[model samples]
Target chain A: MDGMVLVITSGKGGVGKTTTVANIGAALAALGRRVVLVDADIGLRNLDVVMGLENRIVYDIVNVMENKDLPVRKALIKDKRVESLFLLPAAQTRDKDAIKPEQMKELCEELRQEFDYVLIDCPAGIEQGFRNAVAGADLALIVTTPEVSAVRDADRIIGLVEAEGLRGPRLILNRLRPDMVKRREMMDIEDVLDILHIDLLGVVPDDEAIIISTNKGEPIAFDNNSKAGQAYRNIARRLEGEEVPFQSFDNPSFFQRLRQLVGMDK
Target chain B: MALLDFLSRVLNRDEGSKETAKQRLQLVLVQDRASVNPHLLEELKEDLIGVISRYLEIDLSAMEINLESGGGDTVALVANIPVRQVRRSQQK
Candidate 1:
């Protein structure tokens, strides 16, 4: 049976596309699904580093797409921690034009036959790299932040994804701060959903553990206490067709909450 | 009085950064969804003035052309042209 080709893309850079791919790939593998994370951001590849598989890369995706004799398995680097998780690194020396859309589709087809999920790390912008990353995908996960610019870029990307004949992309709003939202200092999930008008895949709260994990070259999904990690796992479960209620990022003070519950406080 | 005013300001806060974000996003997203660039709109407005002025006495400066989002997936190009009077040759 062929697996799903889910391309994780954000039109703007630094909106956590690579981070989402790494965390979700790890989460899915932990759920016992064989997953392959493909970094389609050719020259500026970072998915391998995020997954801590940078040193293990013997062959890149460019080599696999170019060489007819080379088997695709040779480039698949199994994650050190997760048994079922693997990564297909991108070529740093080559440019985005090195691999055509058709070649990327063919590569995904071969990968789908072996893995349960083919998660592609799409590059920023609506160019050749974006086209190549999106060509083979059955589902598109548009990642964005609560910031105005990121949301605008995500809106543009949603139009392009639908125009490509792919299904309507689900949104993953990353780097949210519930405290800021409560204080009316930041855009909340509802405000974002109102504009994007797509089904919500997940909402990831801004957590410092994410940065720590990234620095350590490990996916935050393994840390149970990390709110962002829990969000990624929830996204993975949602992808697996599970209906999970969104976790409350509300600040809970025992005394105030108790008073509210007893109808003594507003 | 100053302390109470400060407390009220802190407690009764309504408009915040999120409100600003929402307003900005709504305006920008409408333009983005309509695929209407401001520069392109300006050029279109100029060309439209030249074309319409040749046939009628119109207020070119007062004309308004806007790309509006008419809800789900519809972009409406609404143009308001104020015609002062029709040209005598065109009236025939």
Candidate 2:
């Protein structure tokens, strides 16, 4: 197809796959690329809710796949805020096995014709849903946390994705607490990199703004002051073939905080 | 000196949670990649002893079989069996 297909997956749940999809999709759309997010996690669909388009999803992906007469455009929900962004919400009432891998691949191939990026938000676990998500994609992004269990699951998922013949499923380390890492209470980036041994895509710090954004059904990538938003923006830039330096997770200096307090910094 | 060192260790508590996690992950990943359980490693060690005893009088008490992470994305099966004595015919 003309556009690239990227599957965002984490073998373990709650590692920020949906959040990453929402933010990265918004960031890319802001960069003037036509981006369509396909929520492959059928039974547990939340991409629409995360993007505040839950009310706009009239026709879900399962309806499109189950009915041959149904056009793909009918299920496509265009973002009211972003000009080039769209989302194909998953079927919450149906089970994950309701859609097959082949069907998902055909849908993605069809999407790739009209968009510059077709990002599939994969479901948790190495089950049918995971298979369906990766079937259509030529590229993969494995989301993981610094915790041991998450990293282990991510390693297994990476092996499975590579076995599928997909190329360069880069790593996105999520929910990294810089203060805990400095105090040696949590795993540092260096230690995680040593074990995973994959190219670093981007590191998102644990920010409270993320939860607030999710609650409001808005992506933090739109907030210019949010650190996590800045990280997602950088990741979008990198995906556009730009060499962006990794953001330092260092805690804000006292001077910087003082500057902010005095309304001298934005 | 021993008492002072003990006091310092208790007071400093330098090693953090991340170090413990790293150690645990390294160990678990090695075992996972090698697909060898603790019981299997012991059984393999016993079988090696049975085969090697025909030529050498080895110290079974000092034998160790460990699954360690090696260089270049590989897991190495490390076997350390102490040889106490050698048979005459097998000597080179």
True contacts kept of each: 0.97, 0.77
Clashing pairs in 1: none
TM-score of each: 0.83, 0.81
Instruction: Give the winner by TM-score.
Output: 1
Q: Please, what are the lDDT tens digits per residue for candidate 2 over residues A178-260?
A: 98887677998789889988888899999999999999999999999999999999999999999999998796799999998
RMSD of 1: 6.2
Using alpha carbons, what is the TM-score of model 2?
A: 0.81
Query: Best by lDDT, which number?
Result: 1
* Every candidate's CA RMSD: 6.2, 7.0
Model 1, span A18-68: residue lDDT tens: 999999999999999999999999999899889887888899999998899
